[model samples]
Target: MSAPVVSVDATPVRAIALILIGMACISVNDMLIKLLSGGYPLHQMVFIRSVIGIMAASVFVWLEGGWRILKTERPGLHLIRALLIVSANMIYFAGLSVLPLGLATALFFVAPLFITLLAIPVLGEAVGRHRITALFIGFTGVAVMMLPATDWSDIPRAALLLPVIAAACYAGMQVMTRKLGAKSAASAMAIYIQLAFIVVSCVSYFAVGHGRYAEGLDSESLIFLLRAWVWPAPEDIWKFAVLGAMSAIIGYCLSAAYRLGNAATVASYEYAALPMAIMLGWIVFAERPGWIMLLGTALIAGAGLYVFARERHRAAPGEVPGPAAERPLRRG
Candidate 1:
């Protein structure tokens, strides 16, 4: 009468490598989205990306066994999971448009901490003193990142909360991924995510496609959020296409990584996204991280990794109930 345990491979080398690839793809996708934010609406980009992503994900569904593979026993959970991630993306991308790329991504890295805390309540899991200490350290890192060294002067105060809130939603979606459904194909879950994205983006278009509602907002983040859709530049079509493709790949890989790898082991590898964000920011945006930012990054990544190490050390043999991120095929 219980749900099946996640599919976990003992040596998930392929899963780890695949998720690292997914992290890299996500970092690149985040950069491109930040680049495009100045000229386009978030919803517009999401809409385009989803359209293309659904098409790409459809190929995956087909490969899995035609469209029937998309069917699921838990449509409601799928719907909730999809909306959580869509909200996460919209918030994170809007913040990315204004915040430094490295800092924003680093902030989002606190998602693991959110997972630990969420697991306690939602999964009825207990948090030990060690993880409690880890939480304290993890949050201190967040405060460090928020210091003036990161240049809070130009940032809209509200924008500072965006990634953190996004992180919470992302964490919630992932927690549910572990608890929800009767275990479906990665392709099926992926298709559900893309379809949810499609529906949300269409609703956004109807709500604010013309920018008439954005008449007075001056914050760059708000502008990015409320901006009207303009046709993609001929040259930028490729970026949207790439984002769509990468979005699909990121979702599929994250699902596979969590499914195949020990949740504790695989969760540690997810930190790879922090460094990828830093490297890509340096290369593409020329954003330099000061020592303060570096310290913040170290604390966030270290705290998260340490949590996994502890989980591995203390848990009983067999499958450990570690955090598994599905992005929920979610986040940018």
Candidate 2:
């Protein structure tokens, strides 16, 4: 379904519901990638998902207007935006292939901190003392979450960077999205993103999908990157379809949520993904964070919410809302 365009009469409750559903889809997508990461090349999985995602995005385009909405004035900017998001997905999937779900999810929460910081230079947005403090607390939470992990040394230090770097790319995409304004239909944006995935994955497949470079790789992430493309096992085929479908669902719902709901309120609700991710990690993978890590996760969420609140407060009566973490963080 098409997301409602932003209107004066907002339906905050329905927007809240949409955000919950979107986050759930994201959590499922993450789990699927992690599961698939062990067996198939990342490009192979991404190419399949992108192919399916293009079809689903077509439906959204149809629902929004028609194929005509795909037209854009700034093709280069869109390509750059698509590249940023795809980079985020690849890096995150690499990390998720090795890290526990809960820790990875918590690390990704640093996106808000990145957004707030990046906004200043990239968007020329003003930041006050309070929001700055929130950024510090959120990053401190990242350190706190990792500090107590007895097994942290076992993980390749580089593997731990997957979520944070991915988050930075995601935030960069959002900044570009903001600069692009609300001119294009969200579905159109999604289509190009899928296209970028298809092109990039195809290139990767041709370059190294023969497993030539995968021979001596010890890093799970690197092996995942260069491994030969395999025909997915029969049972895993449907899971790939689910990943594509989930991507379309996420694009539509998050777009609709931000448009239809109060930005600050709806953005705060997006934090629900943290708990959802953790719970799914526990149930599906039998992984759970310790109390200390949970506390750190809470701190990260609190800081993000605090930033949202500050954005709301800074938006004087009838003035345009400042940027918060309206991240279209489609999971890897």
Model number with the top lDDT: 2
lDDT of 2 by residue, 1-332 (tens): 22345763457778889889988888888889888998999999899988988899899889888988788888888788888889998998889998888788888978877888888998998898998899989988877866746645477877877898998888877777776663467778778888999999999988998999999878888999999988889999999999989888887787667777777767788778888888989999888577767878888888988998987777766666666645444442
Question: Quick one: best TM-score, which candidate?
Answer: 2
Stretches off by above 4 angstroms in model 2 are 1-5, 151-153, 180-182, 325-332
lDDT per residue as tens, model 1, 102-194: 889989988888988888888888788988888888889988877765455677667877998998888988788776644667767677778
Candidate lDDT scores, in order, read 0.79, 0.81
Could you tell me every candidate's TM-score relative to the true structure? 0.93, 0.93
List the RMSD of every prediction in angstroms: 2.5, 2.3
With a 3 Å backbone cut-off (N, CA, C), the pairs that clash in candidate 2 are: none
lDDT of prediction 1: 0.79
Worst 10 residues of 2 by lDDT: 1-10
